[model samples]
Target: MTIEQMKRNARDKIINEIAFLAGGLTSACQVRAIICAYLYVDLVSDAEYREYCDLILQVENKRISQSDF
Candidate 1:
């Protein structure tokens, strides 16, 4: 997939898992770490991986409140 697509996929995956992620501690860090690690391997270079990480972090930090549910 393209870099933008990859970024979007990562963001979506994180958002989807956020609700079931368990106490916002384990999954927030663990899943993001796993995804970023995988992106590091899958991307062409560190730069792309870094961008993916940034994008993923932004997604992970998005505010979701009880009312949104």
Candidate 2:
């Protein structure tokens, strides 16, 4: 698979796993913090990065249900 495709797969898995973490709410917040920092010095294009970031935000904000994953 292409690198972008691989990244998407990893992103999906990470986000989903974080959503269901032992203490999901706390984990989600921690992940969101990392995403914010990782945005800099990262190779992903803004659009790709946004997709991943959006998922975390949606989960933390309760805009999307973790069960939806």
Model 1: CA > 4 A from native: 22-29, 35-69
Model 2 misplaced regions, further than 4 Å: 1-13, 20-27, 61-69
lDDT digits (tens) for residues 1-45 of candidate 1: 787787667666655654445335444566657666656656334
| Candidate 2: tens digits of C-alpha lDDT, residues 1-69 | 876775666566566656664346457666655555545635345775678667666666663464567
lDDT of 1 at 48: 55
Q: Which candidate gets the maximum lDDT versus the true structure?
A: 2
lDDT of each: 0.57, 0.60
TM-scores for the candidates: 0.38, 0.43
Best by TM-score: 2
